[model samples]
Target: MKTSIATVCLSGTLEEKLKASAAAGFDGVEIFEPDFVASSLSPELVASTARDLGLTLDLYQPFRDFEGVGQEKLRQNLRRAAAKFDLMNRLGISTILLCSNVGTAVSADDALAVDQLGRLGDLAESYGVRVAYEALAWGRYVNDYEHAAAIVRAVDHPAIGHCLDSFHILSRGWDPAAIETIPADKIFFVQMADAPGLTMDLLSWSRHHRVFPGEGGFDLADFMGHLLRAGYDGPMSLEIFNDTFRRTDPFRTAVDAMRSLEWLQELACQALERDGREGSRMELSPLPTMVAPVGFNFVEIRADDHRLDQVRTTLHQLGFTDAGNHHSKPVELWSQGGARVIINRGDSTAGSPAVAALGFDVLDPELAAERAGRLLAPPVPRDRGAGDEQLLGVRAPDSSEIFFGRVGRGGVPAWVSEFGGSTEVTTDPLVTRVDHVNLAQSWEYFDAAVLFCTSVLALDPQPSLDVAAPTGLVRSQVMSTADGIVRLVLNLSPTGSADTAQHVAFASTDAIGAARRARERGLAFLPIGENYYEDLDSRFDLKPEFLEEIRELQLMYDRDERGEFLHFYTESLGSVFFEIVERRGGYRGYGATNAPVRLAAQHSRRPIVAAP
Candidate 1:
């Protein structure tokens, strides 16, 4: 695929945007009109810069409100089109995007629109430019892409064709299969964007909420399939208008956008393969097969060299056994049953304990890592001595390392031998394995993290909701595999507070017994208020004895038609904590409804200095 991104999708001067796009491996760019007009560079200079950066000026946009007008208005619009065409000539761009008239169109007559578009096409032809007429979702009359295509056909001018925008088409709930009916040659340009499901005015959503493909709700791969099945082979461009992207570093945003396109291309390729399109006209490079992890191999925690004793104490109290240090590194393993936690005292200067990396057991580790690499995840290089166990890793958007490991015998990683090898030393273990991991994301990169989980990790995202916190509302999304293993909860902190610590929730066979044992071992339980238990009784009217036991244990509870859930949290130890959870019957969720209460409890016990 010939990938491109509009200059509007990033934050920078025009030259900076071009360079960022090129550096991110874009073949071309659509120069959004406002960005060009605001730039200090002339059209020739901008074109020259794009050429120097090894990029093609794909398209110039957007000449708006050019059709369905009276003769006088038509003359003025043609004059405007002439000016833009001249500009495109100077920029060495052959295509100009003319949006279907959104305003100032005096008529809705199809004949008038066709006639005026023909006149504009003549003007474009004079400047050796092609007009890609696009339908705005909120256009006055010609709002549907099929309607715009019909107009283009009636105009029958070689200079005029249809521009298929995924946002405009998908946002309006138009059937994309209709794209296959339009002749491929008539489809002059394609701009792809995705957006979250939003309830707002069309213009407002289109202007501000558009995200790169795979980051939103649209089925862009399906859209791409339909376009490809129609034989349309051209630059697949991105034109996102997001507030975050507009304000962030252009290079970073460009890389994120490029990653989205890479994922989208892979999805489209798979879609075509599913349809048995073996002889595709476009030669798309095939990506490695996606393989989801079967289970977590290990969760690594990093802290100052002398600061890990507190975290280690909590783990020990919670029934984890010391599994000894790595044979070659400053790392110690703690385990409860099959759940392994690696305490890495690698940087003594590191501030507090945090989840530094996660290793998962996949059927094929190298294959999974290769897929992640193709999806634009930066490969994480691990420093190792000879004869060390090699774990392939990639960096997530939040800067956490994700490693893929080969499935070991009896759920134990083969690399455990690199350490002293003792783990959980228990017949009837308290914590069985990692039930889920909670990662805190910065507000700006929350959506990007969601895409990373879905695309790079191959996890499916559950419906997202906002959990009330003492500071502000925190958006939480749970991503997991279909079989209820490998759950990851992503919490977007409203204020980006480091105090919003990352946690690992361990599944217990008996939550009550485990809580009692940990309490006996002196685990500092994050205290729950009496009113919460009072309200809980009102909500579920539990047996008095069970309720009393839970209150004594400081456990939180949630029940659904499927099953009941019981869980308890450990007090924050620097920037890391733990949760022990039990599911009775067939409970599938992470007890999300109690998140606000948990957040409140954690807030009530704050005050962590930067010092470890």
Candidate 2:
């Protein structure tokens, strides 16, 4: 599929946006009128520069408020459109996006609107430009795609056609099936955007909250499926208007936009294949295929000298034994049950005891890296000494490293051999493998993180949830592999926090028993309020003794149609926390229902300082 992005979606000068778009492998750009008006270059120079960068000026956009007005006002609107057509001719742009009258539309007469649009089409035809008319979600008279389509049909002019924007249609709750009836030839342009479900004014949401496809709540693949089924073969252009994207680096945002389109096209093709539909003009790119992880290889913790001993002691309290030391580096290996932890001292971590890296046991490390490269994930380099096995890792948006390696017999590498002593230790361990890793992220980087996991790591994104915090609502999502081997919980941190803290949850056969044992070992659990148990009793039909046991253990419980989830947390070890969890009868959820209580407890413990 040919990919294009709106110039308004990026930050920087027009020249920078064009260059970044070209470098990100986009074929064309939709020139927002404001970008051109503010540009230093002339229209001809802008066109020539785009040509030099191998980018096409796909569409000259957003000639707004043209139809459904008085006769004198209609004449004035035609003149305004004529001026833009002259500009489009100078810029070598063949199409103009005319959003339906969001302002200055006095008459709601359909015949008048049609007559004015037909006259404007005649004017556009004089300049060899086509008009892609779109309906604004909050337009004065035309607020729906079906209504706009009817106006286009009534006009029946060759130079005027429909511009289908996913946001405008999907946000208004319009069914896309009606699109199949609109002739493909009449569909002039297709613009795609995804957004989180927010209850707000439509214009405000459209302007400041649009996100890249697959990063939000919209079912874009289904929308694309309907577009493809209508035989609309055109550039799959992006028209995003996000506050964060407008301030981020232009080049980085351009790359992210390109990745979103590529991922969307691939998903659309998969949908088509599933439906046995053929004759699609789009072709999926060769991205890295999804590989199911056998399990977590290890979790690396980075610490400085001051916090090193505290980290070690905390691990001991939680039943981890120091197994061995790395032969060449200042690192120690610790183990409990089948889970491994690497404590790398002296690494320049953002905070004390931060999760530095996650190692996954895949089928082939080299092949996985190759796949990641195809998906445009940049590789991060590591310093390896002599006889050290090479590892393949991709740097995440939050600067965390994710490494992949082979695990089966004869396929495993000897990187662990560099450790001096035998890593094996025998003990009655309480926790087994890693259940999940919760990565806290800033709101600006949340979309990038979701796209990274879904596109590069081949994980499935679950519906986003809002967790109540002491400060505000925290947006949370869970992405996991199909076979339940790898699970990542991404939380958008509460605003104005110093830093986003990370947590690791380990699985156990009996979470209550593990919590009791750890408490007996002198581990200070994050205390829960008695009111929580009272509320829990009201929510669930549990016996009095069971509720009392939960209250004593300070454990959280959640149940759904599938099964039950029980978990308990430890007090903060610097910026990191730990959780022991048990899943009963295929429960596939984190204890989200208990997040408010946990957040309130944590907030109550925040150390306060006297003002100077």
- The per-prediction CA RMSD against the true structure, in angstroms, equals 2.0, 2.8
lDDT per residue (tens digit) for residues 1-612 in model 1: 899999999998999999999989999999999999999999999989999999999999988887877778888887777888888889999999989888899888999888888888788888999999999999999889998888988999999998999999999999998888888889899999999899999999999999988788888878888888988889999999999898888987888898898888787898797775633567687677777778989999999977899999999989999989888889999998989999999898888899999998889888888888877789998888767777999999889999998888888887888887664458989799999999888867887888888888889888888888888888888888888789999988777555467999999999999999999999999999999999998999799999999999999999998999999999997888999999999998878788889998898888755976
lDDT tens digits, residues 274-357, model 2? 764654555556455657677788898888867877777777777778877877788888777766788888555545778889
Off by over 4 Å in 1: 276-280, 421-424, 496-499, 608-612
lDDT, residue 22, model 1: 94
TM-score of 1: 0.97
TM per candidate: 0.97, 0.91
Model 1: lowest-lDDT 10 consecutive positions = 274-283
**Cα miss at 48, model 1 (Å)?**
1.5
lDDT of 1: 0.89
Candidate 2, superposed: residue stretches over 4 Å from native? 107-109, 346-351, 384-390, 410-418, 423-428, 498-500, 534-553, 558-563
CA error at residue 165 for candidate 1, angstroms: 0.8
